[model samples]
Target: MAASRKVAVASVCLVLSLILLQFYVTSLHKELRAKILRAQITTFMSGLISLACWYLYRRLLAENHTVLACPSRLLWTLWKSVVICFLLCAQVTYATNLFFITTDPQWIAMVCYICLGTLIQLVCCLLVCDLIEIGLRVLRRGRQYQQNQISLKAQQTRTVVAILIALMLSARGLTVGLSPPPLKKVTIPMTKLPRSFDGLTVIQLSDIHLGPTVGRSRLQDVVDRAMATKPDVIVIAGDLVDSVVKKLGEAAEPLKQLQAPYGVYFITGNHEYYTGDVDAWFDKLRSLNVQVLHNEKAILQNHKQPEDTICLAGVDDNTADSFGYDGHGEHLDKALGSCDPDQPIILLAHKPSCAKRALQSKYNVNLVLSGHTHGGQLFPMIIAAYLVNPYYVGLYRVSDHAHVYVSPGTFYWGIPMRVFTSMEITHITLQATW
Candidate 1:
């Protein structure tokens, strides 16, 4: 009952938000406003249908009705038919775009600027409008208490301010989203780190969602930046690409240029499993000279002092098992079991939450590199990201002997709007605490 109530409350909030968005569109140009309204309506209907299907499934499960003896049988059949039609239409639309559309870099950039930029701007505008309205109400109340009329000039000024603020934020977000990620240098002092391995620089790149928008040029820029750092090791924590190997293989070609004295390593992220071609991606990455770490460890030793070594272990994304991919699951034990307990270990996990799990386990992990949150990727959403992840972004000291560094991401995903957060190529230098 509590769960049901929470769902009901969430549904109500979603409906109200859509209504507000609909009302907000009235202030937009006619053609754009009409298109946005249509999109919103379609989205709302799809969500409603999905929710109804889930509710019906739950009801049927609770009743243990294996046979179609219930009155909802007919309704269930109708819903299934509608869902199938929707799926078919969606597949056809996607295929049409994929085959017919030319994903030129300039074209993708323009689309992102027009669609994603506008959407973000509208949301910012709505928020600013609401704040202005509240301020006006407060001012009006105070004026009324003093027996004074609210001036039209004051309201007009507030409106203009709101517009300017929204525009500035939107512009900044677009610039940040489109630009190459900046370099972030971090020094981590480890008590157990071998002196021979001191000053070991590792370049960490994560969440480089190469797809239609993030093409070869963008990836090349990232590769150049990482190489410029002159890193001893290069590690991609997770979420390397959004599309399948066939679609993004060319875009990811720049990765082969990455060179380090140690190696370039990669681990699976949740997105890899979602692509349903995890093995294919792994093979592609391996072909690019990237060592795909599947719940495994690599012992790194200094040539001068072979005895002074550190363990670099990587586990699969925590949610990999849920995708039903055979032999793909996060096994921290498998990753760290063979490592020498006396040596400092750096664990690579896609999600920051895994840092806590590693610390709790018997493994003596000195640091964990991850990047799944994308630092919320946008404003307001960052707040929710903080609530969900153990470490939202930046460096975190989880324990006396352990630290976690969560990169914002190498590239923006989906909407391509990054506000109050930046994409980064994290350069970490290991310092001996002796």
Candidate 2:
């Protein structure tokens, strides 16, 4: 009865997912009926591809003489069908997102993102299985010259190992998604000699994504960690919140507790524009006493020697122009305006690409801190992120005078998971070089 119920559930989910997928695609391209028809055809092709994956799995098992009992085989097929249903739902949700970028993510939307992540994991496992099978076949053909078949036990062992690896990957995804980020300490050296600011610690919290996935408690955890470090200065590189100010205003309340001797600073990230009103978030952060650095600079003066100083500057996200928000986007010259060219400056920009810009600029920007990439967020995707980002993660020296450190994000983005990567809060200690 349980098996039958599982099959029925899979069938229902598959049908509903298909209906939603068609509706979303049709809605998006309603003006072009021919394009909609082509999308429907593509959807049919995707179904065939899923069916082919299952067929290959069955054939591989049978060829290796590792086929399970009738009931077990039936259960396996039902599970595969359920996975297909999940993939369909995920694709539909992504399609819907393109049309309707909600101010706040709904629970259903979160589920879809999770489903999408699981589907990708499943695809990776399938690829591994195929590669293993191909390797085993090559070994079998080689042994055929001696007229000896490969051991069935060996084949079974390979299958078990592959499945175990896949399960471990899935578990890792869950672990990263549910856990709080650990603190990572980093030290940077500056060329200009400033005895007073030496050993000054700066705690960086970037890509917090304070929203449905990351709630008040999560932000509080991050704040507590930052406070524990007793930083002289605190900086939020960007991506403070994912949702609109109205819906997630209270979620960021814990940020008020994030105090530092030099005060907390913030700059705009591309996500700020996505919330529809950049000003609302800016106002909200200001209310918390967090300094908003909108294309400007502030000098940290040394008390003993008032003339000795270090400049801290920040620019808007590079995407601000496409977003069309007022007073937004990277304006390096405006941000460094009035600053002494020889003064040691630390710059904050959401995307690491800004490091290259800082290197080209005449301003004496010693270091640039960023966190837009999230260090690829998950496996295989990291490989894709590398193609676009010159500095994907960790500290990278852009030039002799300029260096960039890209944080692996303090939290996950759309999906509440991290695989093969851990979330982090960075503590950068500055040491002066004479």
- Strongest candidate by TM-score: 2
Positional deviation of residue 72's Cα in model 2 after best superposition, in angstroms: 5.4
How many Å off is the CA of 267 in candidate 2?
1.4
Residue 313 CA displacement from its true place in model 2, Å: 0.7
The list of candidate 1 runs beyond 4 A from truth reads 1-114, 131-161
Error of 2 at 131 (Å): 5.1
Over 100-169, each residue of candidate 2 has an lDDT whose tens digit, in order, gives: 3344456676676676566566566656766877776676654454423344544556555655675577
| lDDT of candidate 1 at residue 333, scale 0 to 100 | 91
Q: Cα RMSD (Å) per model?
A: 15.1, 10.1
lDDT for predicted candidate 2 compared with the true structure? 0.75
- Cα lDDT over the full model 1: 0.74
Question: Best-fitting candidate, measured by lDDT?
Answer: 2
| lDDT, candidate 1, at 200 | 93
Per-model TM values vs. the true structure: 0.73, 0.75
**lDDT per model vs. reference:** 0.74, 0.75
Consecutive 10-residue window with the lowest summed lDDT within model 2 = 29-38
Clashes of each: 0, 0
